[model samples]
Target: MTRAAELPGAASLVLASGVVHLDPAPAVFAAMLDGWAMQQRTRFLKASTIQSRTDLVRRFAAYTNEYPWQWRPVEVEAFIDHLRSGQRPIVVSTARGYQNTLRLFMEYVTDVRYAWPRECEEKFGRAPVQILHEWNTVAHVAEYEGDPRRRPLTYDEVQALFDAADGRVEEIRARRRKGALAAMRDAVLLKTVYAYGLRRREAWGLDLTDLRHNPKARQYGRCGAFYVRWGKSSKGSPPKRRTVLTVPEMDWIVPVLEQWLDEIRPGFGPGRLPALWVTERQSRLSRRSVNEAFEAARDAAGLPEELDLHCLRHSYVTHLIEFDYPERFVQDQVGHEYASTTALYTGVSDEYRNRLLQRSLDRHADRWSVS
Candidate 1:
């Protein structure tokens, strides 16, 4: 079938013909956005993804004060330059993402099958063109583009952070505060996040049923691993799935998780709720709450402000490397698609590096000894 024939009704230009409007420019622009959204929906893209892209398209239009058909390469360059000069400038990665979004939107409108170009040409004496070319857009130069300050926490810092989380619960109980249960839950939640090297969504999306037992590691029983259902999704895809097994080094979490599941979690009255982390309202804990919990603990621990909850995952990767785990094993444990990406997360301590050096020197000692 022709691409145009395959499109849904909303994506077709049949309605644009009957529209006798005072300002056809705005009406045509709105129709084009609706058509683009309908096209994305047919591909099974997430609604939020479609909405954000359309919103960005509208913002770009407002910034240039021109419809898509009237837009030029200069407008894109000027807008990006304006973004870079502002007091709160967007990072390179964010700018690249915006440019790519606009590029895709332009491609969609200009494609022969979409008929947006023909419609615009007939109405406005021009057609939309892709303005974001390679020379003007940011290049994907490096595998890792995150802040350098966002490094993995050292073992001492990890311990201090956990101690702070625990102390917060104690302080609440001592003061006869009403949030003791919530505080304790946050403490356990943070530990679980570090233990399994989970992303925020993966940790918050956990349920009692996600807990699994490894036959080989019968000692930890059902707490031996977790099935992550909300692993980060790639473009136009559902969330990836992975099984994050508990390593021997991080097994301290077995008891921590058990205590929450068996004893402390019951205080929340989660009754029939299957969520691993529940609030007083018996609802599954939100990703925002998880972040707030980490922030409070980090502040109490007096750690650097740059260390966010994801730093716990970085710590997990770093500690696993220091504990002598294989690179492939660590990559699998963290659900990383590439060892290089895992390597980016690893900032091994100088002590660990020194130990490795010493081991190598010991192995080659005889060669350098008096011969």
Candidate 2:
């Protein structure tokens, strides 16, 4: 018999030999999770990812009232069904993600490299199996699985959103409310997000030093590009890095950012704080605060509830397309690895599509003319 140390997977390392428990089932389940976490840590996976995966497994176990060894395809199905039937059901993409996370956990435990199966079978009457199947899980049928309502705001809508954000600052100041400074910061923050086509974390994670001067665009000075250090990362990888250049169309943001850094930001008195956006408490602005700011602006603009802060990113992609920027340029600006991903964010207006159609027809006018 192989000692726990000799087992290939880390699972056995959590199961000390001769360490009996009052409840063997829960003990073994916890060992499986601990082993899996240790294994994932060795791969340099994010702590949040490991914690979320472990939590999902625990939730699934509780929902099914069974241990990992007792989980079956039916339990997976029922768990998802219960989630979908809830008052606030998960979206298709969210459901797919949950299923995939559960599947990955199952795979880790059942993998022979981990030795979870052999240990469970010896300890219990059964062993864990991969319960999530392709047929049972949500299929990745569409390139874009987001809500259809979540789309690019039109030029007018974008203007309205910004106007509302600006109006918020005035409203607070007029009412002599305490949050006028915060409102001003939020207005500029939203504009910065659209200007850079940044994701929420990328925007919030920005630091003062990340602003870089582009030699060719000397007029914008240090506002020429942003060194995005908190870009979305691949699994088991550190945050990706990218330089998002300030395009000519969005040059208006140059003055906006400059004013914020020089005039508005100092009001927060965030002495020695390196963050680009600081709160009243002289701390870095949080991602949740950014979301709340956008929501307030969206509501004030009378935009649909489905239109969230990400719509600004979508709008950036769409407007860039309409501006005749190359697809590759737009993709690179947004740090997308593939142009196809950029296309999913683009929701060009019908007028822009019609203009494209007109250009194509004009190019073929001689061929289209009657003989």
Candidate 3:
């Protein structure tokens, strides 16, 4: 039999004389986690995602008081139970995400290419097994598991929010407040978010040059299309890109942006800043500022507390469907990879549904009358 020390790959460093006599199981386990993190970085996983997965694995290891080689299915169940017993118990979706991270980590460690399993086996006399099975893990039963209270704002609510935002700017100006310009920026930012159906980061990531003129809609001039360069990405991919065309319903924003770019933005003395939304510091606005702007507007409009900035995106989707835009067109406009993902954001009002039903009835009546 070949000595484990002579085994091919990194496992040779840990094993000797058919046994892991040089490195202890704990040391090997730590090294395996380090290697896994490095591998994830090489795969271009987001730093935040990599950190989150590492933390989950570390927490699991700490909970079971055992390394990966000693981890059993029962320990996995216990750790999940502990998570449920916490003060802020993990939600089903979060728990499922945790399980997925754990499963992926296990898969990496046990993969034949990694040599971790062989090293663990040489050290502990047993290899790591994938403890999370279909029976043990949470199933993805729903496409959308977001809070039920969070839904698209009514048309009236959207108008009210925008009005309140504008009102805030006016209030600040009337009081001779120092942040009057910033308040105006916030007001326009909120409107732009609703107009373009933008996610928070996507809205902030906008640059001055992103405002493109659609050759087809020359009447709208420079505000005909929004070139979104930082749309959401999946896994380790770069940000997705899409162009959101201006529709007749949102053409009003053309002038709003035109006035801002031609007048208000220059007044800020941006100098050479390229960001569409700028702060008093002459830097790009942060995501938190975007959230706070929406929150202030939502509260001033007397909307429900559960209504968040994301609800603006939901409202955009609902309104687009009501505007008779094709489903695929709406999906592409919002940068959704799938029609189903776009469907999840749609919360059409009962009134709109009734209108559709009424239209169907009217068509049937006309057909019967002609016959």
Candidate 4:
């Protein structure tokens, strides 16, 4: 049987020896989407990602009140404008993602192998063409498009945040409040995130056994390194894994983790629970809980509301650079595939920049004196 014969309502298009004629344009468009989704599944894309792309296409179709075969570049522009003018306007990055999804869908439909192009041409007299163009879409201007208000906390602010986190436990305990143990866990978890330069999911997905000892950092015992099994993955790939070596600067985590394991965790009756951070129910801590913990600490510290849990990781990168760690080493430490990506996370303080300028001037003066 021919490919067209296999699709619903397309058997009429199949003639002797598997030659395909044009079918109804609308029916072919539906089959084309099904085929595209099947292709995406075969490529190992996550179900969530595929669903999101499908939703975007449906939204676009709804906006124009037309089928894929009838879409035009003008409709694409108008749809983007509608998104921008909506109650909750989409950001540039989000808009770019939507545009890319449309472009890919159009590419698939226009390809001859899919039969969408020929079907559309025979029915409507014109085939679907790519509507998204470079001039109409958002460009890749920078590696980071994060909020400008979000920045790495200074060393003093980090200390203040940690102190606030610890202080919360004492305040609750003094008041005879019930959640002191949970508060302590949150404090330690926040510190661990900063210490290890971890993303929220990375920290949330950690297991107790993921902690390992570094031979050179014997002083830290088994908490000398973090075996991150849930690092961020690229499209259609499994979670990336990396081992983050604990630096001496963040060695304070050693004692904290030891205390949590020996003293605090036992109170929850974790028993055979494998999660390093567990809820009162002995379940693994969630990403939402991590965000709440950081927010609570930020409010207690009297810090800016704009600073998020991610700023802790940003601080880790900036501090590593300030500590004179090699650029390549910093990139590897943060699991960044490119130095440019690591550079985006780095926001060194003015004081650190001034120190660099002074060193550069001193070197230039020494060369002049020698001449």
Backbone clashes for every candidate come to 0, 1, 0, 0
Please report how far candidate 2 places residue 183 from its true position, in Å: 1.1
Model 3, residue 277: C-alpha shift (Å): 0.9
Each model's lDDT comes to 0.91, 0.90, 0.86, 0.87
What TM-score, computed on C-alpha atoms, does each candidate reach?
Answer: 0.96, 0.95, 0.90, 0.88
TM-score: model 2 vs. ground truth:
0.95
Instruction: Report the poorest 10 consecutive residues by lDDT, candidate 4.
Output: 8-17
Ranking by TM-score: 1, 2, 3, 4
Candidate 3, backbone clash total: 0
List the candidate 1 regions with Cα displacement exceeding 4 Å: 1-3, 8-16
Better of 1 and 4 by TM-score: 1
Q: What is the C-alpha RMSD of each candidate to the true structure, in Å?
A: 1.5, 2.0, 3.7, 4.3
Which residue pairs in candidate 2 collide?
Answer: 9-114
After TM-score superposition, the amount by which residue 63's alpha carbon in candidate 3 deviates from its true location, in angstroms, is 2.3
Per-residue lDDT of model 2, residues 1-371, tens digit only: 55656653466578878787887888888888888888788888899998998898888888889888888899999888899986899889999999998998898888777778888888896788999988899999888877898999999999999999999999988998799889999999999999889999999999999999999999999999999999999988899999999999999999999999999999999999999999999999999999999999999999999998889999999999999999999999999998889989988889999999999999999997998
lDDT of 4 by residue, 134-159 (tens): 99888998777767899999999999
lDDT of 3 by residue, 117-154 (tens): 77667557998889999999988988888788999988
- Candidate 1: global Cα-lDDT? 0.91
- Candidate 3 ranges with C-alpha deviation above 4 Å: 1-26, 366-371
